[model samples]
Target: MAEREYTAVVYSTTSGRVIYDLDLADDPEWSARINDVGGGRITVPLQGGAGTTRVREWCVPLRYSLGVLLGDHVCQAGPIVPYAPATDKRLLTVGFKGFWELLNRRVLHNKAWNPASAKITDPSADIAITDSLPNIARAIVDHGTTWQNRPGSFLPLDLPAVLPGTGTNVRNYPGYETASVGQRLQEITQVDSGPDVLFQPYLTTSGGFRYIRHRMLIGNPLLVQLGGALKFDYRSSLVALSIAGDGSNQANTAFVKGSGNEAGTLFGYATDTTLIDAGWPALDMVDASHTSASVQSTLDGWARADVALYGTQPEQWQAVVRADAAPPVGSYSPGHYADYSVKNHHWLPNGLYNYRILGVSRSSGTPRGCVDHQLQAVRTG
Candidate 1:
């Protein structure tokens, strides 16, 4: 692997000011995901110098964010959480979670017109909102982060005031209050063709760090499908590849129960006839506790999504590849499609397969920069 320089910069999360740049970083590893929070870690030599003391003092959890930069671009960054010294006491390792983890700290509150003093546990008199999914997600985030609704949850950031080309599947959010924002956001993604609510961090032109909520609708044009020009081949770019097909979680029929108790519970079910016709046995998966869904279509949507995501046997691909390969490590995000071709596999067909990128984990090589990237993907076609 070729040698490259990687710097770890700790900055204030509140003011976005550079705090300190670590002198040395060892064994840096990071992973990012569109569905949930991503994280990374690095180890630094603790020589008991003034610099080491400064690192110990300023790298407190939540107050500061650690950014791993390759040249000018910030490949991964997050708020520092763990700072532990080695057993030999010669080196200190630090870890951080993605900025999106902040959402876990606050809960969705029905404070549509309530005063700032309103308590989260207090019953809200505001009626449930009926709007598009993207708009609903934006409202949930804004209510949790804006100062006018709640002072402590204020985050000075700019998000999409209006999501472009959002889904028309209007949903209801009646039980949104009291649930953690992170949990609710994830639950909303269980619907058929739901959008991915991602909290992304970026470096400003002036070198400041900031975050934004990006709503990525399913099957949107921004979700690029890479092949031909940008492909992953076993001979080049890919160092290793493995495929696994699991039927343990497979369900030919999916049942989604929503918003009720006992006999009054609302229910919706979907079955994959293709799988059934393919001789797959009757397998059932029940998804429950969608108390926010009041409409029948919303329940049906969840069932369809469950069936699509878990109804059939799932093929997962794991690949170890060069970070600087054709498309590069930082070029594609989750939800994008890429062609993966392997010529001579002992048990599989020798051809190109289209896969959806799910998550990515990259680690620094012996020379220090990120050189190895491992991808987790699912067969989409």
Candidate 2:
């Protein structure tokens, strides 16, 4: 009914080629969507952040590389299962921050002068970080690049990674002695400090990756109150809102038991009270691989994560809004604006509430360069 005017730019960092002028009216077939929609319902999987329980995945297509080329050299391993398209323009092309994430995922060195296939070695492959989950997750994603380019050909993949330690921490290629540049970054964010920590990698307004931990974008919230010119569609578009669990409640406390990895027989344990009410309780937890955190800390970590994730019921609010303004709200690029919280004042059946966009969707398609704030109430008591 309304005339749509917007542009989408797909760039390849490796090739430094930009394909622009992608207006919705130009090609209706080349389109994308925010979150995901099917059967008139829009749903988003768990995000990566504190108090979360799953890891987000980044799988290459059957016959395509990721947005950007990061590994030493890529090749078609062989005929892969399923089916891979001959070409996908989206592959091997991405913005700056995404490329940085890929480069840091793995360690690379050039033996000769700019060799296509460099001498790749990873010192952080076999051992898990044990320091922080984010660091450990980064290590895994770094190595995952190598896996994407393994000798054969595999694409359209969805690799899942579990918690405590990445599933692919101690990785080894089928016939090779070393590991690739990726590790399992698949897991939910543990919510001990605050709510709205993402379980998957989100995109900041600056086109950089947003990890759901700490207070990065919650300083000042943008209010979309009455008459703010906010645009949304219930039936036609794929926007979803719902509530789930909360894991930060006091009743969410539980017992954790562990033992030392040394010669003698050493054991330790703690309850919900000792871990929840008592912020920093002393518990003996020692191991050869990890010692930076105590046994009680680890247990407390899990308890907090559980409570924040599944303890209290969480309210999820998301929408695909539009702005007829000059630069669409979804037209995100670096240095355009800072990552800030967005509150949508709504008229609900019960009453009106201001829900913040706690976690966001990094990948979104725009009909008029518009995007949706995958909003979840930060304080849902």
TM-score of each: 0.84, 0.37
lDDT of 2 by residue, 231-284 (tens): 333333323334433433323333333334555323232233434354634333
Which pairs clash in the backbone of model 1?
A: none
For candidate 1, lDDT tens digit of each residue in 293-361?
667888888888888877645776666666665777667666666677888876567888666666666
**TM-score of model 1 vs. true structure:** 0.84
Candidate 2 accuracy as lDDT: 0.28
* Each model's lDDT: 0.65, 0.28
